[model samples]
Target: MSSANLDQLHRSTLGVYESLLDQFNPGLQRLVALGKTYIQAFQALSSTSEEYFHALGRMGEQALHTLSSRSLGDVIIQIAESQRRLTNELDGMFRWFHSEVLREMENNVKLDKDFIAGSRRRYEMEVHNHASALDRQQRRGHQDVVEYTHFLRDSQKDALKEEERRYRFLAEKHCNLSLTIAQLMNKMGGALHQRAEEWGDCVNETRASRPRTPSRMEQMGMREEERAQQWTKREEPSLGRVPSRGPSPVLMRSRSGSLGDGLGGGRLMRAIVSCAPSPNPTLLDFSMGDAITVLVPEPRNGWLYGKGQNSPRQGWFPASYVEPLDQAPRPPLPRGTNPFATVKLKPTVTNDRSGPRAPGRII
Candidate 1:
């Protein structure tokens, strides 16, 4: 009875495990699908960003081109205008200083004249009463003149100091403005250089990674005929004529069918692989120069579902990897050969290891 209960419990546990797995599988597939979608979206965004940068670079180049076409006279005119403005500002400052100095000197001279006149009047009025008053007035007048001369000298010195301070301030301001302009120009130059370098690198990388497109002749059909002829010549030295001797059975069979039929039918199409793919359940791993069949002509998220012609296995591959055969010229088949032939399979050997070997017989 205990053994029976254990068996029942074991069966129940297995049922639960199976139920959990059934629920998880659909969710897992959804997650994988979402991941693939995200990858494709990210790739598109990256390509768009690259194109935007390219456009910005082109605009910068165009601006430089326009600047190159401008005349040197225009630059000279701009410099002249700036110099004229500076000169006008300096002239205004000097004029203000000159007017201030003139006004101050006039006031000082007027005060001196009034004081001298009052002393002369007093000396004249007291001449009869006191003869020494005349001498004293003369001495006072001399002292006042000396003091006025000293005051004038001091005023001139102060004016000179003020002028020096104003000139120093202007010089310092001009120097600072010049330094700021130089820094700004340097930054602009550096930024332009960096952007140009990035654009150049991007262009080089794009050229290296992108496959070269076939020329007009190759695309139109002339090149395909030539390639087909070359392939035929390489494969068959004799141009469809019966050999002098009896031809072998293999030779009797047309070899033209081995090469793919022309890309006429919608059901059949050929492509040359340009890029390799990583291992994925939906995608096939293919290398460069490999030929593949397009099961679906249109792409889904930049990926195409296809089968390798040589491999004959179906899977998804990047659309960019293969060029469609419809664009190229199709080759005509030689006369008297089936366009489609059955692929031959090698006979399989049966191993009888399951049965006991008789003595003296090789196993």
Candidate 2:
């Protein structure tokens, strides 16, 4: 199944073949030597005379006759037949050795080729699967980037609309202030006219009662002198009560000025104060990619905190038991404030009487 397993099988098979060769080698060597001796003997016999051959046979017969064992002739014939069959089998074994070894080697070669082919096929299939997966991931990543960019653009447009609304509110407040001042001025003018008419009536009543002791000119002079002094006090517009216009765009913009330092001072969208151990506290940790989360003291299965904050509460924690989770890459920050920072918390309500069931106050 595996390349390593296949290799071990091949090694084992080869070891067996080597061991068999070792065992058969000595027998093969002995057979080769015996055959060589027999060939030499035959060559000498071919050159020998007919008388010598007859004498050799008589000598063999005399030797056999001298043996006292019964059936010596039969025994000699049996021994000769046995030698012939042994020699023939030995020769057959030698001849087939070449064919057998060749066939075995061919089978081993075929096995090796098959193992290599299977391994190559498996490797190729794995590579193809990996490539397809990578392509899909790339496509998904591209889509996410496009969606994020669109979201940022929409946020920017919303911010611009909010700024426009603020300016419009300031203009309306200014107009209302102007109308209130006009109304106050009209009321003051009517009061002044009524006072003047009352003075004229008093002068006519005095003239009708008696010949005017002080002339009209004298009365007019006194009135003019008094009026001049009073006018000085009322010279400046009394529009302080008539509300000055609300802060103009210029003044509002000044109040919300840019940061003096290089680092901007806009509200943080998210401020995660990670109390993780520093590599070298004396030096700055420049690893911006690192992120951290606050680890609430609890079990892994979210059982300690209950379902919500309704349970008896504990304060927020820092990054004590937490590890950083890798975040996807993000773009650079744009210049703007987060409106959420402007939200105010509701005032806390407290009961006068102290009891076990007293409500929690949101201080």
Candidate 3:
């Protein structure tokens, strides 16, 4: 009977659970007392339940003795057999109850692990499996991004190489055209000189033959000299066209060198925006904390070309507002080189965010 009653620990747990049940209820203040009454009733039932089991066993024993020397011996044998079977069944019920309920109550964890779903241990295994799957998913996503970045970088490099090839071809074609024009101009000038000399000889023969028209001959000569001078002046600027229009090293490398650097290149060197660039259309717009990918490391007129990591636009911005992410921040662009010197913000003081912060005490 005492075994049927819950132990101290279980009774304490029951009381705690009963208190929890009445915690949020709005109906009554006497709910806690009602729960206590129910617990007390359960505890009191142990004696009554024990008496009932014992009474049933005594009744069966008395019945067997009285019926042993009955009007029929066959009826006595049947009663004894039923009693044995009832005892066995009762014993099995007791063993099952003891193992499943009474022994289970002795442990801190009410339910021992059956290794199936619903056990704490199994739940932990499931959680670990889920966590592993999540980690793999995250790693795979990162790998995909890295691969895509490499692919894009290679593609850009190929495109840049193709552009350089085309530029060289165009420069060579331009040189050929300039050379051909120069040759044609020289040939035309030679032909004009030959014609002028032949015409002068003919005019001299005409002047010697017509002695009365010397003044007319002089006027014709003066007009020819004036015309020749005017034509020479017209051809002078065109004479230096071949060398000037040919390919220059500066123009050739403008496309190739700016965007394409080394293995340690544009992607690694980032332009983190320390300050927001001014609102100018030529300048790329970005806020502080935005990162820019440096496409061109070389500064031109205090400007840099970069594609924004946080944005889609790419253009030149003043070098004053950005600093390297991986490297130590270099001083602002030189005063002579920095065209935005006047507009550039000067930092008078610096504070690391790691510095101790003061709690405001406002009046």
Candidate 4:
């Protein structure tokens, strides 16, 4: 082919490359813009969720202020704490997506586009310069000048071929970001799912720890029935039933030396024998396995008062130190030396005895 014909063919091919670049440029730009829009929407959703959790935390703070003493307020506080953690993790994930994934996609796309476009432009410039030099050399009408221009044109053609090869390679590599971006998205999505699941599990654990309210009439009725049975059993435990937690207020007012049969303390019972030495004066001191009398079967603030079996060592002691005896204790033998030798005289002083108590530390 003639040089003129070759130049015309090269120019025509350059025009085709320009058309393809112009068409593909918009598509690549549109893809980037669309991706940005998608990421922005995702970011907005995350921001909205973070704000929602913050609102919940504020609401929980209000609940705590209004109902500090209530159990419901405590549960609300726990929920708020959990939601705050979720929001923090969500924010971190979004930051990584924005800084790492989105930035990488944008940079790669721009770099690839620039490389392809630059190579095409460079090749076109070299071709144009070569053709101009040939026309100038031919116009000089010098054989030597024409020969030198041909040499220069051959070098330029070699350079153009390399540029063309690079341009084709770059264009072929265009938009290969799909698999890379998809892989990054998959990794980020998995991390997001894991964080969300952890938050859900934490919320579930908080709910599980909360106390359930009585929701049924049957449950209320059952509670009342259990209470009645407890009182009846404490009054007469020989029937073998559940015991009352404490004495009733009305029955606790008995001024008599001995309480009424309704309370479990009226009878004399054998001592539990095991007693620890106490620092307080009101607390009874006794050796291990020593005999004593008990005034109460159950604990009242963890204390019970009674007189010693053979000695005048009547005072208060921990309820844990004694239990009700199945059999009545053997009365001390009426003697001349002992002050509380008579069994009948013992209840007179010990039964009305409600004054002595160990401090809060004793319990």
Candidate 5:
């Protein structure tokens, strides 16, 4: 072919390759965009979790300011709505990515199995050539060997090593690629199956178009019957059941006034509980695990004293000696000072024993 014609043919081939690559580029871009969206959504979810906790803290602050009981419900509803929105956003993002990116990537990305086989065959041929060269070197005549023995042996060894290395490297790469593609396919297939199952139950009823109904006597009677059945199950005694006479004769209590029912105080061990000012506080720093020296809040004879807390030890030190590290949080102001400090806290009252309500929630 003429040089001009050859150059033109080369350009045309390059264009064709580029066009083939371009066919998958849009899908690849969409996959990238989906990943970015998930990351952004995840970040937003993290921020939302922090804010939700902050809102709960604010509810604690507003506990004393109740105009009516309904206000608490409103606050709870708001918290629920925020959580629901975050969950829905995550669900939508997952669905979109699964359908548009992962599924397409698995189902449509054609694997060239023949190329892998071809590479393996070529690698084997190369290795066979190296073995044959080594054999030929070993059989060479002594007269020729005297002049070129070292060079021939070295050349044969180097060539064999290079061939073996290339073979191993190619084989490993192919295996890894195959495993990755298989894992991706499995994950995509599993997710698709799970989603299909969930969608089956949803029954295609959109929120905007679903019908609402109020039932009469039959519904109420059915609910009452269900409740009665549930109640009866608790009331009924099992045939093999052994009834306890009364409260245990043995008293089981820890030195810390805790009921040691397998719920040991291991968490308390090596833990320095600090009374820090609220707005924001670093809860735990894994990086500073043992290095963290904190000032724990103690109700010292009802005066509230915070000193350096060596949690592993039984007692605390003087507040003066225990310096509040810059990283350590300041003590939370007394609930008396902050009216909103204890608002909207879940009523931590247990029905096991009846008593007057206690002050502030413990961690």
Candidate 6:
């Protein structure tokens, strides 16, 4: 073929491809928009469901309150109101579901029809253009025609593949919608069950003249006691101490003592350092499990001023780092001994080579 004819053929083919793309692009965009709309609709449905459930809960509370008033007429009215509200909610949900389904179906049908028509029109235009170009270039051999035919086939195949992909996407979206509907139904079923139970309880309460069984608070307290007993049984071996049924003697005694006098001489409170304090100029550095005396019960700006039991160091530390021990039980002291008294050191007798040394060096 002549160079001019070849160039003309190339431009015509390019135009046909550009035209196909332009036609397909809008269809693809519409499909994406449809998918997004479905997602948004589902989200709105979920939010509506939540609001409905919340309203139902409020109605249940009102019913309970009416029942508590011990007026059978009021309870009956409340139950009737609840049933009416439930019926309305169910009707609204059904209407919404039907409308959304119909709308989605209509949109899908329209998109499919538009896509099919556009594809058919583009295919015809492409074939006509290729035929005209081949006729103008009659001098070209059979091989050239074969190659051009192959290109057209490949383009047609690509368009078919894109259509299939869109159909698959739509199918998946339909499946998702079905799943969401099923989930909403399940939630509604559960809510219905709960409402029925509440109604049954209210009816029973009205019919029975017997004293009320244990309230929820009493039941919870009993459960807590059982759990505590189980926990103490499991922990006693590890703790190496028997679990007391009531408050320990130590705790009772500690509660009886004044806060300041509980520690020693009404000046300090003994505690064990449970954690190491961060390095600070004003804070004392102590290891974990070290004993200390709290000089101040309350912290000043998140720091506690305390003195270490083993060391003479007195400084501030984080209040969280210590466990108070002033309330713990201790052995009784001797009759004449003061608990906080300083010990007096006795003089040491040393034997020299010549004679016994004077008792002057007191340790």
Which residue runs does candidate 1 get wrong by more than 4 Å? 1-145, 182-192, 211-363
Cα-based lDDT at residue 38, candidate 5 = 68
> Looking at candidate 5, what is the lDDT of residue 180?
52
Minimal lDDT window, size 10, model 1:
239-248
Of models 2 and 3, which has the larger lDDT?
A: 3
* For model 2, the run of ten residues with the poorest summed lDDT: 302-311
Whole-structure CA lDDT of model 4: 0.56
TM-score of 2: 0.19
Best by lDDT: 6
Error of 5 at 202 (Å): 34
lDDT of 2 by residue, 69-103 (tens): 22343344333443344344434443343344333
Residue pairs in candidate 3 whose N, alpha carbon or C atoms collide under 3 angstroms: none
Off by over 4 Å in 6: 1-79, 91-101, 131-140, 145-150, 165-176, 179-183, 204-363
TM-score of each: 0.22, 0.19, 0.19, 0.32, 0.23, 0.32
Ranking by lDDT: 6, 4, 1, 3, 5, 2
Tell me the whole-model lDDT of each prediction, alpha carbons only: 0.47, 0.39, 0.46, 0.56, 0.42, 0.57
Tens digit of per-residue lDDT, candidate 5, span 208-260: 34543536765666565666556445643333311222112122244576643
| Worst-scoring 10-residue span by lDDT in model 3 | 108-117
lDDT of candidate 1 over 1-363, digit per residue (tens): 243543354344344333323433334345435545654565565556555555544554454456341232333333334334433444444344334433333343355345434533443343333334434667778312333334334434543453354346445644654665566557555665675566566556645766457678656465556555675556433322211232223322323433222232113345444445555455577665566665553555556555666675556655655665555734446443333333377899888689888999975
Model 4 CA lDDT for position 305: 58
Q: How well is each residue in 233-332 modelled by candidate 6, as lDDT tens digits?
A: 5633322222222222233233336433224521344444444565644557777566766655455555566566667666666655555565663444
Error of 6 at 295 (Å): 96
Say which prediction, candidate 1 or candidate 6, comes out ahead on lDDT: 6
